[model samples]
Target: MQIIVRAYEQSCAGVLVDEVTVEADVSKTGQQSTFSVALNTPDEDGDGYVAILGNGKGGTDCNDNKNQRGALMSPGNLEVCDTIDNNCNQQIDEGLDKKWYLDEDGDGVPRGPDFISRCSKPEGNYMEYPDGQQFDCRDTGADAAKMFPGNSEVCDGIDNDCNAVVDDGFPTLGETCNAECGGVRVCAADGLSVVCSQEPGRYYHPDRDGDGQGASGSLPTLKCGTEPADPGTVSNDDDCDDADPATCEGLAEVCDAIDNNCDGVVDNATPACGGTLKNVASHYVNLGGDDWKTVSVAANGSVWVAGHDGKLALRRPGAQKFESFSHYNSAPQAPTDGSPVLNNNNCGDHDWNVSWVNANGVVFLGGQTGWIGIHTGAANFTCVPGQMPTSQDAITGMIGFETGGVTTIYVGDTSGRLTRWRPSAPFAEQFTVVNNSDFAYYGLHALSPDFVLAVGNSVTGSVQKFVSYDIDSQNPVTPPTEHVANPNNISGNVRSVWMGSATSACAVGDNAAVWRWDGGTGWSKVVGPTGVTGRFSGVVMRNDTQTQLIGQCYIVGGDGTSRAKVHRLTPYGWAKPLDIQSATANVALNDLAITPTGEIWIAGEDGRVFHYPEP
Candidate 1:
């Protein structure tokens, strides 16, 4: 109820100082029940409020005692948070109390203001918070238990603490670090650093070669799901050569001196390109009258040469001179190169007529009387021993292949005998009949063991004969296919033949005899320059394992008496190299071979060995 106390503010204790009339709530309990507004002049309770008694219109003091010492319960004091009404209001602690909602999650935090008003905690006396501390961010559902003050920051896509920030502690989270992978910097598991999930399946690496694999030890830099978000990344890491696209995992190793298949082996499948270029024009001249008839090259750059009647020579790798191994030479001569030639008189030197060196640096030799042997840098030659047919002439030519300890060789002779010889086989299976009266083979070669090409003139040197034998045939009497034509036949006998590939070959002979064979057709006769005539006995094609000699065909031979030269048998015709013609003015070069190191060794008459060093 409103109270109108007719008193002045300065003298409300006993006597009125000035005339005034005020109205306030004076209907408090024990508010001067029998006193009137005038009789309320007694300063009971000693508070500034006068009890509104009797009529209760002017009773303002809620408590007044006989001793007049009332202090807390009166209209003159401010309301406080006690059970008693301090301001003489009927309600207890009315204006100064608070309304507390329930912290149902019991995180010591409340949600909204829908609560019970009380001076103390109403239901549960949880810890008290200061003003403005009751608005919990998440005080209801499953997350309400943690939506309290000072909550630990976590990574559940929400703010657990009441800090006004979601997922706190990760200060830079949701920020763009490696934005290309994604737009958010995720909180790492350890909470020590941030992470971008799109980067590196920790498997998506850089594929610099565009191969399906990346370089070894490559860093992961892409996210992989469908096609990689980064186009240069791959799911694998098996690329040994990051710069070469063809040098990835599962590739067939090529002859490029690299681990093309990523198998930790470099060029293990194909042989590497070899041959040191001899840009300088100089040859060694040592033996006086030794003639070299055959030239064979090995992978280690060794040059093997043989001739009629046990003539043999060898130019070891890095040697500048040929070692004449023939016992026919009157005396062994010293070489001009600083390196010495070790004369290994293998098997006491018989009539070694032909030579062939496989890729493994194994040398096979053919000799007169149908003798065959092998020299593998051993102390002695391993000769296949057995008495052959008395009609077996000299071993004119031979070509062989080796796999492990096994060897397959085709040995040809001037007696028109082509025999199939294998390791430990004394008597070989003869592939051709003994036609000593008709056919005499000279040079022999094979692209593979399946096909063998033997070129020669007739028994009387009247006509050229080109024959290819199929060694794959089970019949030892397999018929020889003659690459022959009747009308425009090549006149000069084909002395030697070299096949560049199964499809291309060149046969060289005396009197400017030259013929090129195309697999599509038969051999075609070729003529040389008219005035400068020479016997072209050796033919070789260049192969670097990358490009094919740029279409260059080198034919080495010379006029029988003098005028040694190197002639180029081009697609058009033959052209003589005058510089080589002048280098060996009188000597006649007989055979030439290109070693694995790309060195071109030319064996000539008089033990004169000219070299075109690997370029």
Candidate 2:
């Protein structure tokens, strides 16, 4: 028996196996049998190889023999076609001399003959192999040289080494680090790199300085040792005392120093007593050699003091102190002249009275200087334009008119004659004698421009009286037409009378007599409290509600102690008098003036001005 087989050749030698016959037909030329096996014809272009099988020697013409066959005819044709399985071993053409076609368009269809090229080629390329197998040309195929390294043709996201993932071993381009943790890979054909940022542990670092950069570690280093001190903070060594930062240089010490903690003062460092007292006289001069007796604050706030040492003192709100000189000696010779009287005894006696022209700022002073003086000063004191009287009459009381700018000075002599001096010119001429009378006008005050009230006694009867003079027309030269007697009964001489602007007045005199006049009413006696009586030496009308009567009273066995008796005027009558305490038992309150600001300045015989802030 014989069988036909195909043998693969290494090269294009085109050798074939011989056809052999079996011994079943051993008799030679027995039936003249013959057998033949055909070989395929080669192509004309010499582009193909073929396989053939033939018997080496023929024994009979095997066409007539029934049971004898020359060679078992092969099932497959011996033609060298491009179809796979040329040897027919189930896998066609898989051993050697195989060819593959690349579907460059990736359509999966190959350009080949006698085959269904419509299916996708596994390798998509026309690749040739020597194993006579047509492979898909993938990495696992026989002709897989065109595949990537490691024989892998799968698409991966990354080029593991960053070479770009054109033909890499991964299924897609290998994943890359997307600068984030545990990122995944994406398809390269999708024009994106694989994000393989699956770092085990990573964290973000904030740029504290806001420099648009991040730090590599968990905790970033600070750029400076400490933050700069804030505008007024105590850090960065800027403040001397960080604990007490407010204590710094050049700050106010208040009442502490050493900076108080550094503020730059010693102790009690701030300036002290830097402000001046308003309306207070800064310095005081000894008026009348510190023997100032009676000081009166005029209605316009000017101050005048009279002394027993024959001096008249003057002071104003801003004066350094009280200044004194004899009114007679300091009298100016002319309206424009100024003089300072240094002599203490220029006036012959200590008695004097002073009053102010409230509307005109004129000051009138009359005393035992043997003359009356009027003074005016634009800045400092200047004597008014007035000549001295030739007579030696002692002027006891003086007062300026409340209206009409009239000033009347009353001069009293031991002979019971009283004379009046009136301003005759524009304060530039000396005053002239206006009227003379036989009544002893010791204490006088002009209640108004038209009325004159004088207090004194008659020489014949020694009867104390209050006389009112009516000028009729302010004609100082004409004799007064109206006269009135003191309405109250009194047995002693009247020493003084103080007329309050509100029509209340007090008249005081010897034998502890005190009389009060309210408006146009008759005078009434002012009774004192128990154990307070002797004589009322001075009387000044305070306000409508009260009166201050200062005098000396017998304390023990006629010792003659000084006293300040205050009496309140009630609706019904005068209330009981109250005594003011004295530092010493016998201190006298000689005179009193209620200042414009309501302070009571009391003059005492001890040459002191006691100031009561408000009384």
Candidate 3:
């Protein structure tokens, strides 16, 4: 409610004429809550607004006391780019803010850092905010035409693509580049890139048989290109026989007369032999094969059994029976029973003793009556001409050529004569007597390419001795001198010898007298088994993986009871008889062979060939 108090003039009738009024708002509840009041007044300035007495200024004008401007700043006034509230209430140039740069070159891009905020794009390549963010470093220099990021780079070491790195995408000076076939290219001397050239030669190994093994020689086919188009050819030559695919290094040695394993050695040394004896054979019936004297396994696993009857028998590998060779002293003819045929000329009647040959598997035989022959395949044998003169000079032992391509066959005779024969030349006498006595040399061993040892007994003294000769000497070997001194005048005759190393050699003799030779200590007698009544005919040293167990002297001979006796010499001395076959009259083991597979083979009287373990 509005309450007004008026000043009344005390005049004659209290008519309340021309009175001044004062007013205020009053609450009816008397609780002093919020209240407002206004005095009714007229609109001044014709803007439909006014202020009343008893109240603060209230109007639609910034200055209510004034009448000209209505609101503090009216809407729809033109905005300007000023750092002030020019339109009045509060803000500065908000919506009118525009970033513009000076593109003095007019290339549609602007120069560095020289820009301003404007309402719109100015004339002549000037851009606003987004398009103006691009800053050009040069505006009037030689690079100005290429100032844009899309411009290609020149060799001036300047920024390209507007990125930081200089001369980045261009070829680096002196950097090397390679091609497919060993060709090389480098950044050029003139500071440009060079073409890939000067390719290397292409060498290929021929494998016409597709065996995956290359040829044997060092020769290779050279060309200039990528690999040759032939898949059968490679870059290595190692295959000995490239005409047969099954003759590679990975192929196992089959019972064929070929180097199937490509190991340079023949199939005789293959690893397929079981460790123990197997498939023992005693005799060949109905086949003119009897009393086999010497035996050898050929590259094809064919066992060549030489009989005392002057006939040769061939047992095919893995076969149970043997067949006599068709022709031993006549024209070559195929055997009827699919046996190996032979042709021999002037190989006099003699008992075969030793048989061995060179790495090429050429067969050589030595025997009684000064007889020595060479087997030239297809069942053909030719007596080596100009052999020792008399039957008393029978070749007892034979060893193949050693060192160099010398091809010297060292032979020993029962008369103690030592001879050296080159397969290409006639026999040359080496020594007529060894150890200052005529000892019947029974066995020969090559300790090294230059060193050879001959073992036998001197009939004059009835004692055994070994003679060493250096066949490689410039001068004739200082006439075979005694290497071992018989301290006790050992009465046994050494029958066989084998060398494990240049300085490590072992010799076995009558009554199992084992003698060891060390370069530093010379030869000393080591006591062997006392049970051996007969002389050891053959001995071998096993140096394969079983060296810990088998690296000893394996001596084969017989006891007086006519049973085969095999003994071994261990570190502590000779062990008891390692193997002793049942006693059979006239059954004596004459030789023993150790195969590459660690198997032991024994050949003896009565055409006996026993594989270890009887497998």
Highest-TM-score candidate: 1
Pick by TM-score: 1 or 2, better one: 1
Off by over 4 Å in 3: 1-279, 282-289, 296-303, 314-323, 326-348, 380-386, 389-392, 426-437, 559-562, 576-586
Superior candidate under lDDT, 2 versus 3? 3
How would you encode candidate 3's per-residue C-alpha lDDT over 223-258 as one tens digit per residue? 566545466687678776654454667777643224
| lDDT of each candidate versus the true structure | 0.62, 0.43, 0.57
Error of 2 at 382 (Å): 5.0
Q: Tell me model 1's lDDT, rounded to 2 decimals.
A: 0.62
Identify the candidate with maximal lDDT.
Answer: 1
Instruction: For each of the candidates, give the backbone clash count.
Output: 22, 54, 18
TM-score of every prediction relative to native = 0.49, 0.42, 0.48
Deviation from native of the Cα of residue 389 in model 3, angstroms: 4.8
Off by over 4 Å in 1: 1-285, 321-324, 328-344, 379-391, 403-405, 424-437, 486-489, 545-551, 558-563, 575-578, 581-585
In terms of lDDT, model 3 sits at: 0.57
- In candidate 3 the C-alpha lDDT for residue 546 amounts to 48
Number of clashing residue pairs, candidate 1: 22
